[model samples]
Target: MLYGVCYYPEHWPKERWPIDAALMREAGVNVVRIAEFAWSKMEPRPGEYDWSWLDEIIALLEANGIEVVLGTPTATPPKWLMDRHPDLYMKDAQGHTRGFGNRRHYCYNHAEYRRLSADIVERMARRYGGHANVAAWQIDNEFGCTDTVRCYCDHCRQAFQRWLRNKYGEIGKLNEAWGTVFWSHIYNSWEEVVLPAYTVFPMHNPGLHLDYMRFASDAVAEYQQVQVDVLRRESPDKPITHNFMGYFAEVDAFRLAEPLDFASWDNYPNLHFDEKADPLNSAVQHDMTWGLKRQPFWVMEQQSGSPGGNFIFAMPKPGELRRWTYQAVAHGADAILYFRWRTCLFGAEQYWHGLLPHDGIPGRRYEEAKRTGEELQRLSGRWLGTGAGAEVAVIRSYDNEWAMDIQPQSFGHRYMAHFKQYCRYFYDRHIPVEIVSPDMPLGRYRLVVVPHDMLTHPASAAALHAYAAAGGTVVLDFRAGIKRPDNRMEERTIPGAYRDLLGLRVADYGSLRQGDTRPVTLVRGDTAAEGHGGGVWYDIVELEGAEAVAWYASDFFADTPAVTRHAYGSGTAYYMATEPTPALMDALMDRICEGAQVEPIAGIAAPPGVEIARRTNGEKDFLFVMNHDEHSATLALEEPLDELIQGVRHAGSVRIEAGGVHVYERASLRRD
Candidate 1:
């Protein structure tokens, strides 16, 4: 396991490395990612390099018993590169060429840019390639920024044409998919199609822009590959990684994960979003990291505590910070890292703190970091290399997310909300879920949860229907078949593909809004109760043979099927018509849970400010229980456990105090 920080050695003395390392060691961190933006210090002039600064920093840290994950400084082209080879600068789609100013500004498609950037990468690796402390090599930072600022220069235009030729094989096929015949948008030649997001609102066809988005993502990967391929050639023994921005739709992570030796990402949430974040969002995002290689990756960046001001208005009422951190570990992160180990003095991000606050006082922020560090270190090794095996798998697709967002909603559709609600339902259960690719093996789990049931790949959909048909339960949510791959809705109420699996036709899909919820009554044993109403989380299901599991009131569709269960083949399928409240989701999930015989880690509670997660390495399991809440609850633990953080080995369940964290390892697995 690796808990690390993005450490900067510049502007600080060599002694600073030791202090940070000691602090990190106390926090259980064994890795330090250095130099994503150290170009100015590493290379003083064009075609010339300086190793004195980086050398000392690397050596000092290595000698102090810390591992290093070095980075190529190509993310931000040095001021000199831009001044001399201006053509190497990136030209935006709107046709504005960028000058050297911000990081990740290089035009990925530019010949000169790749050549210069590749040279720096080769040079950097050649120098530190042999260093024993270097565990991995990170490529340049986040790839595409303002999606519209992509290169549409002559180079991109020419390449885009050739790329189109290879993809569609002819302009006719491309024209048909993009609906170019409409609005006089049909192209006579491939050159007409431009990259997506080049304009605020696309005046042309969306498929043209959609294809461009896919192409641009691949282009960014091509740029990352330059650094990665070079590093592999230069240092064959070291693992290679790059930090991806969390939940970023740009630059496909699944495809990009293919080139790297492993995965890592930066987790920055909407400030108010921390608490509001559905647990599945974090799970899905982190699972992307874990699922990339199906192994534990590093936590490259997290907030130590709340930022002083919110992006809008919500504030982290103190304990929320701790809850968020433990949540990461619970999901399968081997380490916990923040954006900076030390606070910045002047920058767009200077306001964010590290282990120390900007005020440099012995105040609340520093104490929280120091305390968390000590707790992490104490809990080290006990949970390292642990795994949280999930019995339920969620199917997520990059293409699906892309396709869903591009369509205009005639019915006021919100993709993000629907997906979040569905995911959160499972997340609240602390259910370890494997967010598999659309085609990954489906039999390893007892069930699967699919949200926004649109564009189910032919083979993937078959496997899904087969899962339910084979007696495995499935939860399929909203707009499941509203659109085909062509982005056009079929006239049918349900897709012909999974007719038997669902056993019902979605006659109408009413908006399942948060405020639109009405009183819903449960129908299962002792489960019968009147609960809250969710306006439209799903739609109206006209039962072909499925039983009416629930209904609506106070509308023409009142007494209509809002929820239904269909026994198809040897299995069962549930179609939710509208968004159900948390109570309803739990009730529905419980039935599936009973059938699957799946139980979450025992005696677990994600109390208001506290979060719980289970991790396992083989059969040696450990439960991470954390209290991010200021006011503590007497947390009951699942038994026959020993405390890793406190180094206290005990049997059976125990109580966790406020602002407290406990990592309980099974006694039999330990020799200590």
Candidate 2:
């Protein structure tokens, strides 16, 4: 495991570089990331370049035995470049050029911008690519931050049209795919097709909007590949990765991760607004990032202290800084780096706290970070190359999310919220889960859950149905498979392609306003109970060779099926017809897990406020037990086992302190 921080040598004076490096070494930091936002410092003018400063910084860090992860500073274009090409900036849906003052303002499709970006990346690679100190290359800071994805500029419009032409080929096919006849949007020529911007009712043709999302995401990936190709060509030995933002939907993270060596993401837990930071949310984010390449990932930029920038800021408790760092490791993070070495004394992030405060003094966070670094070093390499082995895989798709975002029919219909709810339910019970794209292979999983999947790709749907038919349990939630890949409504039943496997069809459904409720009664093998659902939407389902597990208990759809299970081929498919509460979802998950024959770790259910994760190196399994709450909790172990952190062996039981973690290597028994 690697311990590091995002360091900006350009932000500090040359005289202080050694001082900062010494402090980092004192804190046991082994790696430091630089040059992510230092484009202006690298190239002060359009044609002029300055490499001496960065070369010195890299040499300084290398002298201290700390490796470096260099970033392509394309995220922040130099001010000179932006000023020279004002037309290269991204334009809003209102067709007004978004002025530059912030980073990530460049239009993705601008030819001049692409050329400049490639030039910079090539120059950086040629200069420092082969340096022994450079271990990895971060392509960009964050690919699609600030919703700068879909642009209305002429460059983007022309690129989008070209992309459409390549996809559809003919005008008639384009019209049919976009369902253009209904809105009188039929295009006579390719030039007539414009961006789905400024629609009259705020909702354009669904297919048009969906394709725009695809094109924008593809453009970002293609732009990244240009840099990737250069880095691979010049510095073939160093691994390459991009720091993805948590739950960022602008670009398909999974697809972006496809070309990289591995995956990584920035995590800011305390987006504090008086709301309790749910540690499970961060866990899911970590799992999603790991699932990108089905390998362990890095927390490239982790929150060190209070996140304050024109927002509410709350300092972490004494033990929280260390605890959260370990929490990242617990969830398959091979490398954990703090967001910054020191808080910036200037710019919009002046208040965004770091391990070291702006005063350059080692504060409480620095102390905690030092302790964490020592602990990680002590346990180094024991778990490297090990990955979380999950029994359940939840299918997540950016295409479905994009489709839903284009038209979220209900006020409470949040794409990520539903997906998180499903993850939270299983995760809270200590049942390990992997959040994968719909296209990933599903046969290895004991069960598969798809939540509110509004759009369906034909290949993915076929793969899912095959998995279910082969005896793997599948769970499909409401609003799933309602639209085709072209974003057109299916003429068949709701959950069109999956209807046969589901053995149920949506008879009627309605969207519910906030606080609206509907009573659903469970009826499975004489087990009967009532639960309230329908905060977002509810469906009245008609069974076709399926057994009703639950039915609506009130309203016009009274006694109608709300949940059903069908035996398809050698397996079963479960359908959830409404958005259930956390408790209900957990209860249902328990039943589903039972049917799927999936069991919790070591035959134990994690205590409340505690999470359990298991990672295996294709040999032995290491269990990561994390107590999230502020109070201590006790656990009973079946046999004596080694606890890595405490360097103790426990037989009967152990008490985990508040925000404490225990990594245990299960004991092996012999039969004589």
Candidate 3:
């Protein structure tokens, strides 16, 4: 229930601090985050430290009844530190150094940089760990922002060599795992290994490239662990988190969040007033962040107005910002903090508008935010322990995503886009879904969807097989289990590890050109429906103790199984040989969910442009209905409920305006 803004006392004059604090309190802001990017201000010299300004702001905000979430200033080291150690700069793929003009320039593997980061984090934690107003600590700014996750510097190269040595144990094992015999690229010694950069062409050894990605991700995680260890020692009572960016997959978010107490994300949907955007784009990310820890999270940097950097985006409509905030909460966000209280007057982010304008005038956006805060205050404490209960989970794999990026096989075959495509169907029907990693247990979910997971581990395959055998439905698509964890092709048939579980084998496959599609016809007992297929790739699937639910209608692969279903011990396993059209996917999901007895959250499909979700503790249940369309939506209620936002009771039906949100609490019904 923490509601606030990301304030920057360092960005304003000292005299304006009091006024800002008062205005924030009046606007119902109960918390504020500061000093995530104020390294230079905190540490002016190499070893000198200054906390006068920060101390004053924290004390002033506390007096005004606002708590503080202090962040480690390690994201941006002081110019003095960078100037002293020039080798700390991260080198790009072309061996060009990323200079100090922007943030996150320091290489994570650099020894000097790690030491300095640890020193600054410990100093900040020790100074404010016991402060009455300090509530939590953020480890660093966005970990992989600005493509800084991958560094080709000598420090990273050496660290990567050590990492490979640790993983493979010996050079001969590394050679065998990487399949280095094909290109005669076998390494004689550990020193001979190099990063996958500056190759003669874009093609680097697939095994080497995949390992480098893992090594780089580990390096970043280890770097954060250093600060995490220091903060836990210094501030054991405070919670820790790192703000992750939406749709960012440069580093493994699950791994990054493993050390923190909970998860938080920076949500900037960047939707304008007139733009026709998919609401699922933001909803899926919220689910992803929530799935990181499987708990309620915080929106660390919620977009208040138009977001701008290299290019400016259109401003949100009057009620759009409030709707976006409600959307975040609808998923799993227990706390919401707007990106900034006021826009900056100078710097690259000068044009990034906040609640208040650049003139520091409390205008339309500020009033809207104030109204949201007021409404939220009335509804506080009721939703403190509630979280989404999802029966369907979409399996996510960072390793497979990275492997696909290395060799996409065909154009427009994106990993994330494919994930969204499948999730969108469930979203449209208001079915609660969770995005989970494949390594996690699958028994909790009734249906598990694994889409285009190219690199499959044996343990993950075994888990899926067991889940299906134990009365869970599993849906897998083409190119799944085609490669091993080492990024090499499986020695067995296509769909290597999944062959037995899926009850099918891929005879052959081919990539389709853009704007070309093969027709498919799905047959269910007494009816058949035709739909388009193959926007990216398709596989000719041969049935093995399975039933063909769909078949290609045209092209050389006509009459072949495009989709199949096989009943394992107590459950069913479904497989897709090609990407289906939206209509076809809907039909497929309908049949699968019907068999699994899964239903939408509202007991029926929601109207177009309307989104529905539910959150509940063991006692109380809350339903969120949002209308993202341009016109009003009228929904029929199944039972009596209280609309908490406006404190109205509705039993028959309710009309929601455009860009409106309604939160309903069931009346007189409590579970034991």
Candidate 4:
């Protein structure tokens, strides 16, 4: 595994370079990422280039036995290029040009901006492609940060029209697909089409809005491909990657990662610190990143300290940083690189702390990171190729997320929140899960949980049907398959395409006001419990060929089916018509997993705040047990295992302190 920090050599003086390099080497950091936002330093003029400063820093780090990961400066184009062609700036939805005072201001569709970005990337690749010290190349910084992915400039408008033309083949087909007859918005020619912006009201045609999102995502991916082309030609041996942000759904990450060698993500969990939810949320993001290419990934920008630009964040107390580092590794990250080597003294990110404080002294955070590095180095080769072995797959779709964003039927219906809630259930039970794309094959998974897939493609619907038919259990939440791919409501019954597999039809549905809920009674065998439901929305189902496992006990839909189970072929398909309380969700998952024969990691019954995940390489199993609580947790083991971190062997039981982690390796799989 590669362990390092994100270094900004341009921020410090020349005399401090060697000191930083030596300190990093002492801390067991083998790599440093530089030049992501140093465009101005690289090119003082339009065509003039300077590599002296960067060259010195790279050479110094190399001498200290540290490798380098060079980032293309395309994220922050030099002001010289923007000043020459003012049209290169991105125009916001309100028809205002976002000038070059900040980063990510260039429009992806602007011809001049694309050419200039490719030119700079090509220059960087050629300069460092053959350097033995350069380990990998990162293509641009966070691709869609600061809401820059959606541009409404004339360049984008023209490009969008051409994209539509290619997708639909003709204006008439476009009209048909977009259902433009609803508002007499039929187009006569490609020139008549306009980017979805500045409408009479806040609403744009759903179909048009959805298509625009697709176009924008494609534009960004196309822009990255241009840089990827240059890098492949210049640096064929070095791996190319882009750092994706957590919970960022504006662009299709799977598509963005398609052309790269592997995927990496910037994890700043401090920005989303919740005592109970943080671990599950962080694990989901890590798994999502790994699922991008289904391979081991790197934590390109791991939060080192309290990250702040607009608002200050809570500090990671004592062992929290170490815990978070291990958390990332436990999920699937093969490498961990803290955000920065030292806190900056000036700029908007001056308050964003790093491993070292502003005084450039190694402090608490630095020492903790050093200890983690040493620990990880000790177990390097043993777990390098192992990956998370998950039997449950959670399906996530950008199209569905975008559809919900365009027209979220209820005020409390958030696509990502609902999706994460399903993952949380499995997480709480210590069941390993893999967040996967809807288009991927589902045969490898024993259970598939799809939450609120409002806009479902026919291919995805067919895949789910086949999976269930082939003895794979499927659990779908409310609003599944209500709309077509064009973001138009299906003319058939509610849960249109999924009705056959679910064996039920929604007779009626309504959104509940905030703080209002109806009671739901669920029965499993002889056990029955009453739980609250419908804080967001509720659907009244009239069963056709399914059994009602749960029913509403209040409201107009009282006693109607709120949850159902249908025997479809050799497997079972379960559906929940409303959002259930935490207790109810846990109960439902327990029942579902029992039927699916999916067991938690090693079948170990963990405490409430303890998390268990396993990584395996078919021949060996490595179990990562984490304690997220404030108190110690003692877990009973079924067999003896070798603890790699402390180089100790434990059997019967293991004790972990608060915010502690343990990695146990065994030669045979526990499930086997």
| TM-score for each model | 0.88, 0.97, 0.97, 0.97
Error of 1 at 586 (Å): 2.7
lDDT per residue as tens, model 2, 555-609: 7887888788999989999999888876567777788899998877772345799
Comparison by TM-score, 1 against 4, better one: 4
Across 1-672, the per-residue lDDT of candidate 4 in tens digits comes to 799999998999888988898899999999989999999898999789999998988989999999999999989887778889899889988899888677998889998788888888888888989899999999999998999999999999999999999988989988888889988999999999988888788688899999999999999999999999999999999999999885799999999999999899998877854433367778889989988988889999998988888777877788988899998888888999998899999988998999999999999999999999999988867778668778899988999999999888888668998888788888888888888888889998899999888888899999999999999999997889788888878899988999999999998899887657777777432223645454688998988899998878777788788789999999999999988877778887899999999988773456889888878887887888889999999988888778888888888767889989888887745443
**C-alpha lDDT of residue 385 in model 1:** 73
The global Cα lDDT (0 to 1) of model 2 is 0.85
- lDDT ranking, high to low: 4, 3, 2, 1
Which RMSD values do the candidates have, in order? 4.1, 2.2, 1.9, 1.8
Q: Which tens-of-lDDT digit does each residue in 393-420 have in candidate 3?
A: 9988999889988998888778998888
Off by over 4 Å in 3: 271-274, 524-531, 603-605, 667-672
TM-score of candidate 4 against the unseen true structure: 0.97
With candidate 4 superimposed using the best TM-score fit, by how many Å does residue 367's alpha carbon deviate from the native?
0.7
Weakest 10 consecutive residues, lDDT, candidate 1? 308-317
**Candidate 1 error regions (>4 Å):** 13-29, 85-100, 145-155, 196-204, 269-284, 305-324, 358-378, 408-413, 491-493, 509-514, 518-520, 523-531, 603-609, 637-640, 647-654, 667-672
Clashing pairs in 2: none
Candidate 2, after superposition: displacement of residue 309 in Å?
2.2
Evaluate residue 127 in candidate 2 and report its C-alpha lDDT on the 0 to 100 scale. Answer: 92
